[model samples]
Target: MVKYFSNDVDIRTTWDLVVSAFWQRYPNPFSGHVLTEDVVFREVTADQRLLSRRLLTKTNRMPRWAEFLFPANLSRSVYIVEDSIVNLVTKSLTTYTWNLNHTTLMSVKERCVFQESEGRPSLTRLRREAWISSGVYGFSRPIQEFGLARFKSNQVKAMKGLEFALSNLQGLRLTVAERRHGVSPASKTQ
Candidate 1:
């Protein structure tokens, strides 16, 4: 299955700590992009029922204030972030497993397809086909190197944002390469 490393930390408590630290103000400036409101806040279980009411009163299609306040359950942790460049919506979820050590793992799965009102098919058909054909492999060497380099460059600033939440938690060790299993039949002949 999916391979992930364990970190010695309490997943839930760490998550709460991190959220509280970063969500006080909107991370990115709302310049050029259309924002309905000036500020947003973190949502907890207590704010679930008020979501529809808030939505009804807001002028923006989806207000950032209400968006962040939505309750995250086991299935869906976060909703799609507002992006002005693309017309599609994107969302992400993260899960933690408590075992020998508390392991915090995150997977980002995104779709950029919009549904048709008349019940037409989605635009992800091409992406799905390419994925099935194994066209998209693991991250490229350049991509990996760039990611690590960026992380290193911003380590101090990044940690400042996450330290409170992750103070007791250790980062999960990540594999540099993606593991592949079962060779293609065509390669067997070679």
Candidate 2:
């Protein structure tokens, strides 16, 4: 069985900021489960589009009831591959990600698109979609359902991480501007 999920949200930030935040979103408090990320490839196209591929390692703890089904040597970490395209002309970023391990039990593929909001120029629209499937015959239905639920929970944390990164980026810019003006950070409080 296969299950699908989709969601759309508008973030009160410009598309450029959103794109910048995405590149720095890791190591945030909300994403402790994400262990590491490495850029495997990146290139700028003739059309001024940026393409990138990254590999990520994340913790994947199984539920207590499901623990007995897997082999003892199975690693607690899962590998994920993400591919992204950034179109400077259109002010859009699109990414596709999928897990590289544990496919026999469950597989999840996700795609996200970030674009400038049509109604509000200062806002960015994020559209996310996911597909989950399992090959286990009798357990496919339950496994797919569990995958969908977990995906939803992880997405909440992902958004929080993004927000944290955006705030940090803005704060850094503010500090740089203040320093250039010869204004101390302490002076702002006074």
Candidate 3:
């Protein structure tokens, strides 16, 4: 089992190794790269419109072209334009094709433990101090029994790797498929 942690907080533990492996295989796209003015300043509305039309006309098993037509609400025009450039670059540089794997990782959460210590009381204040220490000790036993220590340790490890990847991959971008306006007859309606 692998663990992930961020900012001293545990995120996930089990199956984290799988996630890390996937990340290593498919590194983030936007990593320490800058977009030139030519790339960012170029006109895209016309191209987007053209692409949208092509997307509507091209009907195939994979409806990826439709991404240009009805982009996700969160999609940015700049990223889309950049993606178009990347696509062109890939086509031109046949020897250096881009390999991006768009996959999601699953995470699970479980309860964990925390501990704190209190100072021992003087003999003169034995009654009050005894109850305090006893209560604290009682809670610690349950926390340890729950295997929270193990969970926390794993969580920390997983998150550290995730954060490292995210930070290093400077140009990481996520693309979501857009939905077409018309629904197919076979599709269920809301």
Candidate 4:
């Protein structure tokens, strides 16, 4: 069985800042399961859009009830491939990500778009979609249900991580601005 999920959220920030935070989202407190990220390919297209592919390694922690179903050889880590495009002209970013292993057990794919909110210029909107499926014989339904639940939980963390990164980026920029003006940190009013 396959399950689909979709959600939309407005981030109280500009699109440019959201995009910047996206690239620096790792190492945040909420995303400790994300082990490593490597850029496999990156280029600026003729139309000035940034295109990139990345490989990410993430810990795959199975629910205790489902652990017995998986084979012993199955690794505890999952490999995911992410492809993204940043279109400067449109002021938007889009990304697609999917796992490359253990498809027969379960598969999850996600796509997200980040753009400025139509009604609120200061806010950025994120539209996210996900598909979850399982090929396990009699356990497909249960496995798919589990996948969907886990996906939702992880997405919440993902957003928090992005917000954490954005907060840090803003702080760093402010510090730089203060330094450029020869203002001492201690002199600034909190």
> What's the TM-score of every candidate structure?
0.23, 0.97, 0.19, 0.96
Error of 2 at 104 (Å): 1.3
Residue lDDT tens for model 2, 82-176: 99999989889999999999998889999999999987879999999999999988888888988999999999999999999999999998999
Between prediction 2 and prediction 3, the one with superior TM-score is 2
lDDT for each candidate structure: 0.25, 0.95, 0.25, 0.94
Which regions of candidate 1 deviate over 4 angstroms? 1-18, 25-139, 162-190
lDDT of 3 at 111: 24
Clash pairs (backbone) in predicted model 4? none
TM-score of 2: 0.97
Cα RMSD, model 3: 26.8
The true-versus-predicted C-alpha distance at residue 142 of model 4, in Å, is: 0.5
Clashes of 3: 9
**1-190, model 1: which lDDT tens digit per residue?**
2321212222233223333333332233321121232322233234231111110011112224324533333222222232111112221112111111101222222222112222322211111000001111342333334323332333334334344434323322111121244554455568
Arranged by TM-score, best first? 2, 4, 1, 3
lDDT tens string, model 4, 44-76?
A: 989999999999999999999887887767798
Show pairs that collide, candidate 2: none
Indicate whether candidate 1 or candidate 2 has the larger TM-score: 2
